[model samples]
Target chain A: MKIIAVCGMGIGTSVLLKMNAEKVLRQLGIDATVDATSVAIARESRDAQIILTTPDLVDQLQGLPSEIVPIEHFFDLEEITAKLSASLL
Target chain B: MASPKQLSNYPALAKAFADNSIRVGAIALDREHAIEMAGELLVASGRSTPEYTQSMLDAVAENGPYIVIAPGIALAHGRPSEAVLEIGLSLVTLAEPVVFGSEANDPVRLVLGLCATDHNSHIDIMAELATVLGDAESVNTVLNAVDSDQIRLLF
Candidate 1:
């Protein structure tokens, strides 16, 4: 599965999330490709199956093909993994 | 500039983000100017100049809202050289909603301005700020703050 961690800059928190997601996927024995991108670029990145971001930017994503996961705390790796797992199907 | 502990206070937070070179304030204006305002504050803090401010704003404008960094807070910043002489912070509160390209679960209220001299240093500060913002109570306290001194005590 492919996941894209989206945020304002796509450099700091998004990169952190991508690393945690990779670790989580490894622990779950699921092979996944996790990438980080800014919200603007994310809108056009069709390669991603899921987009993770905070709640405030949720509304801005209106017609994207990827499913959106709103993360309240970017540091909550477990929560992020859980949400990603449930959305994988 | 103030220490991270002192930055916990509102006034200190404001002043910490400020320097003789940077101008910070609470502005009740249109949301479109959010980036502009943030840039001005950074410049006034003596971190950058108008050219740099404009570049940072342009980066965000091209990339969408880089403002929504925290839960309810937006940290508007760009490449260090876009407009930064040194690392600095600035704060601005909006009276109303400003569309900052966030998901439905989070809305932005407070804007923390960042002017970093380099990527590594910026990341360090960003990590620290993220840790502080992850605490719900602390963030709530900052949101509820009325005065700068009150903000200091909370930190």
Candidate 2:
């Protein structure tokens, strides 16, 4: 499976989200490809199974082939862990 | 092999804060002032040009406050542009939290200004900060820190 962590510019915030998401996938003993992309790119593409982003940005991705998983708290690892388990496991 | 904690790049982000660029006080006004202060912290430390703050402000006006990365914490940054001078970090805790009008996260108190020379250069430090601030308990600890030393020692 593949995941994309997205934010406004795919510069700072999205990169952080991508790293944490990779760590979560590793901790769960799951193998998946995760990429950090900008909101614009994520909106135009559907190259990943799930697009992880903050709740607010989800609206901007109105019609997309990929499922948008809006994370409530970006810093919390436990939240990421639980979200991944529920969706992928 | 070292544990996951050891592998984290908290040290990289820690150095910027170690340069004594943090300001903890009751800085009032609006979100722009808070962001400007955070940017000033980076500029005064020689990490960025004056254009860095303007770039940050422009990004907000164009994209909204997507910088509010977490509850009570705002990670302010702009793209790798001419405004960027160097890689830097600035942590400012306000006495009164300022609202950035983010739909999800608002009333941010921790303004972490990220000045990256390029888009990819600051990824390591940004990831490190995210890891270090991953837990509510840790976030609370940093929020309650009495001095810059206390917060700097966190990373």
Best by lDDT: 2
Colliding residue pairs in candidate 2: none
Once model 2 is optimally superposed onto the true structure by TM-score, how far is the C-alpha of residue B96 displaced, in angstroms?
A: 0.7
Return the lDDT, model 1, position B117.
67
DockQ of 2: 0.51
Interface Cα root-mean-square deviation for all models: 4.1, 1.6
* lDDT for each residue of candidate 1 in B95-123, tens digit (9 for 90 to 100): 55466665532456777667666545454
Which stretch of 10 consecutive residues in model 2 chain B shows the poorest summed lDDT? B2-11
Q: Which of the numbered candidates is closest to the native, going by highest DockQ?
A: 2
Q: Per-residue lDDT for A40-89 in model 2, tens only? A: 88888877889998776788876888888877678778888998889998
TM-scores of the models, in the given order?
A: 0.64, 0.88
Kindly provide the TM-score obtained by chain B of candidate 2 when compared with the true chain B: 0.88
Q: What is the lDDT of residue A11 in candidate 1?
A: 57
